[model samples]
Target: MMRRWARAAVVAVALIAVSCGGSETTETTASITDPPQINRWVTVGGIEVPIGTTDGPRGGEWEPFAGFSHTPQGAALAAITQSVQLSTASDRNWPTILAGVAAPGEGRDLYAAHRGLVEISGTDPEMVPTIVGYTIADYSDTAATVDVVQRFSDDSLASSTTEVVWTDSDWRLHLPSDDTATITALDAVPSELVNLEETRK
Candidate 1:
């Protein structure tokens, strides 16, 4: 469960950073327009994540995760891209992924330090969790919360709530100061969830 382990490792920063300190943010929703297309899927550390053709990753020449649009679709795409990167990051690329996707501050440092302490493995490509759908739970010009639904090899479903903030012309994953970001097991995908797989089909 490399994907699940990575997810836990990153989310566990709440407790790990208690002694170090973190950052906080508020959620606000305006109107959302222009749903981004799942132009393709890319495999990172054996985990698959969608890439958008229109909304972002507009700049991947320097860093694969460097360029993203500042729109709602960009934020959502960024949240999904960053989530998969965080969940699948290994020693080989964790630092690069963290640097490109994570917002700068105590939180990112804490996450990096915590991941550094652990030796991660078990990235069985067949068993890894696959992102199935997503919902933009909340959105504003500055911040957005995206609920990403992932289905593991066992066929069970879970949703990770990722919050990203606009920073320096791009959207970066924002680990909540209080460790409030969460992954919840789901009985079934919520009706409101947008199925990116369906869109791709």
Candidate 2:
């Protein structure tokens, strides 16, 4: 299920990138806005899924997968949404990853995971989980490079530099297998979080 969600996120980003014609310059210069209020809830088949919140040095944002499934698409969208929300909350600049991306509900199983991560990890600071960090390590017409820092509950920190290419219309993170392994080791993400009833539009 996680794989499926990840694939869906990849597809969504790819589709957006393609539709956008890949012409926009990759810039992290945009100023960040206030963190979005957690007033909105994702409804799937009419059921409500609870999303978690995160508390960091720069206030807090919703963690992805808080009340949603852990599918590939869900994780991907969660990451994106969390990044946007955190940037806004921190009053920092916005990242280009969300420029033309659509809202979360557009996808069913693909709920945001960052919110959940925030909520869960925030509740327990000992378990420090890293989401997306925006630092301009490299950039080009077709790609942007970033350095991400992932922290654990044991006071240990791991860093990885990844390059995201503009594919289809969205920027996608390119993680090597080793980096993937390192991330997976940090936390045991749930496989899926499905809604029992249909959500109302």
Candidate 3:
């Protein structure tokens, strides 16, 4: 996954985030799913997440197929970009990654992995990872999917995808169900959790 490799880099937040090798693409592409009007910004984990559909918003905007899947893909890109792409390896980043994951000990495991990545990469002031590109591989009304490609300073490129769920109020990383975390490109694969989530949506 993009984040798996990102956590091992020199603190993703320091990344310069450039489009892989292709010309940088913006959100102006007309889509059948485009809304009548655009929202200025949306709240995610209390942070004002920008919309990439105009003026080529920078920062946490995960340069991907925005507005294509609306809430699902948009939220996935934001969280992935913020949590993994430009991560500072700070505890503050954990809450957003853990917002909707109610698994008893999942946060600790993810945090530990995150810390390990930072430690492995150490700190490099000159380090900057390039974001090649991302695609919303597939999606459904309740599910959003995406694939992000990035290149670290070492010249190694990695790609990963994640699923996001619209919890009515916010979009969260769609985690593996309690029974089984097995997931596929088009589906979440059933888990032990009856409702997919341990708690109500």
Local accuracy by lDDT, each model? 0.65, 0.29, 0.36
Candidate 3 residue lDDT tens string, 23-100: 133323343232222234443322223344432124332332122223433543443444342233334443433332
Question: What is the TM-score of candidate 1?
Answer: 0.77
| Candidates in descending TM-score order | 1, 3, 2
* Top-scoring candidate (TM-score): 1
Task: Tell me which of candidates 1 and 3 scores higher on lDDT.
Answer: 1
Q: Could you tell me the lDDT of residue 44 within candidate 1?
A: 62
Candidate 1 local lDDT, 1-201, one digit each (tens): 556645543432221131101112232232354456767787665666677876666433224474666667778778777766665666677787777777888777777766788876746554566777778888877788887777766566777778888876678888655534576767799888777776654
- Cα deviation at 174, candidate 2, in Å, is 2.9
Per-residue lDDT of model 2, residues 36-99, tens digit only = 1233344221222223232111112322122211122222233333333322321122222223
Give the Å error, residue 96, model 1.
2.1
Per-model TM against the reference:
0.77, 0.29, 0.43
- Give me the overall lDDT of model 2: 0.29
What residue runs in model 2 are displaced by over 4 Å at the alpha carbon?
Answer: 1-128, 175-201
